[model samples]
Target: MNNLKYSICFISFFFLFLMSMMSMMFMIYFIMNNMVIFLEWEVITLNSMNIVMSVLLDWMSLLFMMFVLLISSVVIFYSKSYMSSEINLSRFIILVLLFVFSMMLLIISPNIISILLGWDGLGLVSYCLVIYYQNLKSYNAGMLTALSNRIGDVLILMVISWMMNYGSWNYIFYLDFMNNDLVMMMISFMIIMAAMTKSAQIPFSSWLPAAMAAPTPVSALVHSSTLVTAGVYLLIRFNILLIQSNFLKILLLLSGLTMFMAGIAANYEFDLKKIIALSTLSQLGLMMSILSMGFPDLAFFHLLTHAMFKALLFMCAGVIIHMMNNMQDIRFMGGISFYIPFTSLCMNISNMALCGIPFLAGFYSKDLILEMTSFSNLNLLIFMLYYLSTGLTMFYSFRLTMYLMVNDCNLLSVFNLFDEDYTMLKSMFILLFMSIVSGSFLSWLMFNYPYMIYLPFNMKMMVIYVSLLGGFMGYIISTMKIYSVNKFLVTYNLSNFLSLMWFMPYLSTYGLNYYFLNFGHNLLKNIDLGWSEVYSGLGMFNVIKKYSMMYSVYQMSNFKIYLFSFFLWMMIILIMLLIGL
Candidate 1:
């Protein structure tokens, strides 16, 4: 009976999601018809179409929305069974529905304000789900994640303010703000900061691995389908801004750094979920780097393909973890391929897609990224870093897979091998099917279709061979336990260094806090704690300070003074009005 209830809820939520997608499609069709005259406001000076406001509806937005719907639906299906045993299953379902709806709204939002509203909604729901465990540790992780994302939100709000002051909030008004160099620069930087935070770039990324405190379904949903992809989607939405600021070069550099750092971090992680988490960051960085080169189509292609394979991998990991009674550390897992052939096989296929093996989904998208790097006259050092990061991806991907399935001597024996849940297996099968086929179809649609879609440059045989060699060498090194060479290579140390630098900005914020506190204390010492002295000089103030009941009242009233004072009231009202608008 409980199973039936769960199934009913899952199916109902999925149906609503489908309806939402259909509605969005219908809206897109209508919007496209009036694309050239969709004015921000119908001016009253002349109620005529002559004052037309042009809005462009290219294939890129359509493609992004399609992928968003596809991944959201799959996540809902996967989570149905993955979260079945949890006590708050109903609450989980509600959050999942809200997440899908928010993502859909974000993707098709025609104006910046609508986009931000959807973005904040998605961020809030993600925070709630992350802390679903309700433990101290999970709660802390959720708080940190929310804090990092709020910083991004602040940056986005600044951009919105710039837009309001110059261009209309509608994206079609980009041209109007293009001439204002200072505002354009500010907007560009803010958008990039938001993307970095959303996508879990470097220092802002620790929250991702911490987020593994949530259920596997939540990890799969947030990592592959909805939350992190919001950053990439933002880049696609603001492609015009990227092109205008020549910010692509800076983005490319950051993406390369993030990719390299994440790949190295994945190697040090023993937790199965953390390994996948770091890999997600690396893959996202690669896709963002490709997009930064002005190839939105390539980025979208990779994003779609990555979602399929990564979701499959996470589902397979969930099965293994469930069978092991929630043991997540990879060191405790080995030689289970024979026990769970279905999962092992699915994992292998997904791993192939992840590592960009030829003829797999990852191969097509990764090849496009590599091809782009080869053709562009980017700095040779930057190109080398990109290539090496790709190699590292192969190493860590197969290293985890090999540890689980291949190393017989290291196998962690399974006592209850047949204890697999039917619903979980069913979800895994669905993901496996999609992981195998989605890539080729997306590639064909992007490159071979009769559209104005752009393709990155093709690589020659030599470049392909070198990339293959690098991938193979990485795998060989991982297998042979070649630590000495790896140590000398400095990739690991470099990753740590870069991560430290990436985190410097955050650390500096704390440093500033420390400095201010110390400075305030010093100033107080120089003033001889004058406030206390003043209270001591006045008999009534001194009596109140010494009296326990009076001190309690003072403490209680402190909060009121902090919040309800005249200046604070004005600030609160101003903020409320801004948000309301």
Candidate 2:
């Protein structure tokens, strides 16, 4: 049975890798010819509106599909080793494949109707994957993830209905022409809201970290390429309508806040998967903000490159977690690099890439993004957010590295950690290679000309300066002995707020549900267990019991009362007969 599951995994990997290569070839051909192919099938027409299913074959979609397939292929293969002992390995693999298929549907669809189908599919399947462990935490996280994305699903439905004004659902055809129309602007707002929810920006930001309840393989695929990026990809498709628009500014501010918030939150986080998840959130904010700034190409570039390293980061984390017997806390993980050298190498390199180290996958995109932000005419707040968030990225990355690799071992005395899982290591190597070189390759392929980032020396060095400062702080902070004073306790309220993502999770869950839950409690008191019982069951029982007791007392009357009643009846009968005569 285990062999069967492994065989299934290997077969799926083989097909996915083949498809990824094919997608890459097609994307290259499309780029060379500068061509987009749209195939439409008419499902029906209603009230002069043609409802058709569309497949858009463009360089962007093909490129994204390639990356999705590549990561998914590697993740599935990794799962063969990571999830080898599980009884439901086949079920888990099927759910992941379903997720990938959903993303593919989303990528190819130019129509809002089709997009919603894919959108809902992603949400539903993600909920399934998030709760794969069948635990309370996983259940809660799955609920959060599903409900959050459902908001986007609803917004997409609104966009679909609104698109009826154009007599079609093909948003691609209308996006360029409807920029100035009021109705179209409303549709754009809905689209942006939808995108924000999927991408977990601002108030919707709580779910991404909570989604860490999922298996690490799911995280590698969902966080890195498929689910979270779906929103960014949608916006990239609709960037023409959003550029210079009023909503774009709002998006910019919110996304900036999101970037800052997630970065700070990650620094305070201790869980390995969640820290990576928060970093994913931070990078997502960068992509959204940059996209709102009217550079879809740059956002797409970062999206691709970020996928490469982030996926590898999660895989390495998975290997470490497996070795540690599911110990996810960094506090308990020190000097793991000494035990698992290859996994540590991948982890450190991915961390460096995440921090935008020079010449890595992240550097090619993230550094250019920073330079572009500096070149643009932006306000001081957003500008500071961009750079501060960048520093925080380095801070947390370095802190995590120190905790896991540099410090002394904090695990139990008799633990055995080794790097002998060839299947997992092989899968990680694919992403490791991509994480190292995909940045420059994507930069060349995506852009016909490079961005001209003319900035002052001080401005050009801002990223490095902030990064260095963050790293210094991380080292100083991590070096503090555990026996020393508890700084977090000294500023308990503030530390708690920052660490809890400004209590965004509470706001999303308890804050939103408090009134409704209170109302339900009242209903239970007043209706289900109160007034309802009185008017129906208890009241009816009381009435029946009262009548029964009264009748029994009458029946208990003596023989004299029975004889008098019989004579009275005879007299009444006689009187009636006389009157009739």
Candidate 3:
């Protein structure tokens, strides 16, 4: 009976998945006909400015929405078996539904102010999802996730304020006009900063790996399709203004550094989800770098394709973790492939796709991205970061595969490892199909023409060469016999930096805020508790007490003081209204 109940819920999401597929076909047709469907309702107009609620249905939004719904449905179905034993399954389901709703709102919103509803919703919902397990790790991770994203929220608010100068918050309408105006550079910079925080770029990246405290399905959804992509999508939407700014060049450099940093961090990571989170960060950086390099369409293409494989990757990890009794450290995970061959197959396929194996989903976008990067007029530092990051991706993928599959089984001997979970497998198979074909399908649909590559043969095979070297290095490193594990002890400083993600977590959490915290403490002690109390609460009371004592006899006829107080109160209100405080 419970199984039937579960099936009914899964079927509901499956039906939505199929409906999205059908809608995608029509959306493709619409795009082919050069048609865009947009709707807007003016909510407020004041001082010649308009605040409107709007949704734009062009190829981008429809296609992104289709993929998001498809992934959400699969995730919802997969959660049936994955969370079947949970006491609060409804809470999980409701949270997932809310996340999907928030992402849909974000995807459809064409106005910055309207998008904030989705943005804040995403942050709040993600925090709820992350802390769902009700443990210390979950609590800490959730706080980090919420606070990191709050930075982006604050930036978006600043963007709204800056955008008011144009008399409208509908960025799509003014993007072209704003592209030519150097005066709007601050708004563009704010958008980039906000995107960085949400996308987990360098210096703001620690929260992403920390967010692995969430359940695997949430990780798959948030990291791949929704939360992380929100920033990239925003940049894609605002690409016209960004492309015209010097900030784009700065963004390009930082994004390349982020890709390199994340790839390197992934190689040093041992936690299954953290490794995958780092990979997502790496890919976010890739998309940002490519978009900053002036290819927003390609960035969006990669975004969709990455979603397919990465979600599958996390699902496979969830299966392995489930079978292993929640063991997540890769050091304790080995020989899972022999016990769970189906999951192993899915995992390998997703990893290979991540490494950009030809004809798979990742290859369709990633290879093209790298090719474009190479062809662009980039400096050696940026170019090397791109290629080295590619190699590092393969390195970590191979390392993870070696640890999880090729090594001896480190799990308890008494455990029963089954390769069968129809619910989980059914959802995984959905993603596997998309992971295989979504890349090629999107490429065919989105690009009417291919890019021209004039690179030499050696440059063309650069990724292949790096991939081979990375795979070889991963093998050597994963082996306990060949290389001494204590080599990191000798190079402890460098290894520690990479292992700790350049200490970004510490920096973001404590290092940057230490002085502020101390300063706040001082302010609390000296001003808040002492000076503020003296001046406002007790001190003002004493002053008024003394004055009242002095004026007790004179107050019988003093209406001027009352009149003065009334005028002062009115003046304060008028000032507040003027400044919008």
Best by TM-score: 2
Residue 107's lDDT within candidate 3 is 88
Give each prediction's root-mean-square deviation over alpha carbons. Answer: 13.8, 4.2, 12.4
Q: Rate the local accuracy (lDDT) of all candidates.
A: 0.74, 0.93, 0.88
1-581: candidate 3 lDDT, tens digit per residue: 67665765677587768867976986788878988888988888899766678988888888998999899889988888898887667768778888888888888888888799999999999999999888998998899999999999999999899887877777888888667675588888999999999999988999999898889999999988999999999999988888889988889888998999999889877889889999999999999999999999999999999999999999999998898888888988888877888889999999999999999999989989988888888899999999999999999999999999999987766776776798899899989999999999999899888767788898899989999998998888898633335474558677788788889999988886789989999999998889789978889899999999877744765888878878999999999999995
Worst 10 residues of 1 by lDDT: 48-57
Residue pairs clashing in model 2 are none
**Candidate 3 pairs with clashing backbones:** none
**Candidate that scores best on lDDT:** 2
> Residue 65 deviation, candidate 3, in Å?
0.5
RMSD of candidate 3 to the true fold? 12.4
Ranking the candidates on TM-score from highest down gives 2, 3, 1
Compose the digit string of candidate 1's lDDT tens values, residues 1-581. 67765775678547855764764575466445633223244333455323222233445555555555655566666666677777667678778778877887677665777678778988898899889988998887787778878888888788788887753667655644473477777788788889988998755776777778877877887888688999998887777777766667777888888888888767766789988988898998897888888888788889888987898888888888877767887766778887888888889999888888787888888876787677777888788778778777777777787678866534355445565666667767766777777777777655754533244334444345655765566567556755455466667766565434445434634654578989889888766666656655665666766797855765678566655666777989999999999
Which portions of model 3 show Cα errors greater than 4 Å?
Answer: 1-8, 42-51, 481-490, 513-581
| Residue 183, model 2: Cα distance from true site in angstroms | 0.7
